[model samples]
Target: MVDRGPAPRRGRPPVSDEQRRRQRLAISRHAVRLFSEQGLAATSGEQIARASGVSERTLWRHFPHKESCVEPLLTKTIDAFRTVLHAWPPDVDLAEHLRSAYQPVLNSPSATDVEAVLAVIRLTHDEPALRAAYLVLRERAEDTLAEVLSARTGVPSDALPVRVEAAAMNAALKVATDDLIHETAESGITPDALLRHREHLADAISFVTRRAPGDGRD
Candidate 1:
């Protein structure tokens, strides 16, 4: 055969950005399960690879370390929240904006994926490495929140209030999420309960946006 050029890589043909994200998420799911079942310190890279049905090399290709496996669980909510904010109507109140378009995790989230989220949360309170990974995910999310807040408030993202609002909102979200996960772990609660709690979350978010005694919309 004439030079067929370098052989194409294996796996799905030319994975799209979405596909790559799904693959990373799949790896994370397996890692979370392994971590939860065997404790973070006891879970091995080999085990993560085996759980994901990928080789050790493939596991490393998807995640730098096993602990980062919880990245998706902690960060996925931010993406959902950002999407809602970006689409929020100019004339709608914040509470209504969230309720009408909140996209409850139970109503919209995949059942398979929610299980992974639960496992990751169980690991978060116990695993130092996973906790660090969760923090990194939030740091990136805070940047996303800053942009969303800027767009909603018509303020420069670098403005003091905008940054502070982003930080405050991100922190509140983290706390709310942490509490929900903890509650879920204890009582086997549903994600609907999490959405129900968003009212208070919305109030906390609005408090920051309304702190200057002005509109909370663009």
Candidate 2:
């Protein structure tokens, strides 16, 4: 997990939505480290709070349960992918757009953030609660994905093809992320090294969608 220097001082002014989000993300980073070092069943909310330099009340205020603490980081990953999809040009192919915009590193997210994400994802394979949280976030992403696909294809978001493609895209992303993380564990994972993973993700998405160039009506 990233070295979050310090939690906000107590008795500070009320936080804005963005401040609250940052706090949650900071707590989440610490929680992921604890979860990685200790299994979900062994970890406690109090431990997470202590690790985050926040109170149990504060941790619970941000996350309902220990497993749910991972939501913010997973949500960040989903949001990054959504940003790429939303920016997809009508004239460009999906793979082509992703190749340019979908860098996992060498961009906004730090190396520590990526490692934390990888740890959380790996844990989900054995931890049912964490898996639930992860899948739920991915499930929620379907709507945003459907909307973007609809805009590109001129199909209603509710249409069967659009919905199926959106869901498939999510699955493809999940699979690609898992594969890349696993592969990078043995080899060193660096900002530049992650670009290959990005390419792999693009390839997975392209294979699953089989979308044609100029498919976007818009």
- The top-ranked prediction according to lDDT is 2
1-218 per-residue lDDT for model 1 (tens digits):
69889987888677688877877777877777777777988989998888888889977887787777777655666777788778877667765677667642322355555556756766666777777777787788889988887877778888888788778877767666666666666655565765655765676666655652124433
Which candidate tops TM-score? 2
Query: lDDT score of model 2?
Result: 0.82
Error of 2 at 177 (Å): 0.6
Q: Report the error of model 1 at residue 1, Å.
A: 16
Per-residue lDDT of model 2, residues 90-177, tens digit only: 7778888898888552235457887888889889889988998888888898888888878766779899888888888888888888
Candidate 2 positional error at 175, Å: 1.7
lDDT for 122 in candidate 2 is 88
lDDT for every model?
Answer: 0.71, 0.82
Deviation (Å) of 78 in candidate 1: 1.3
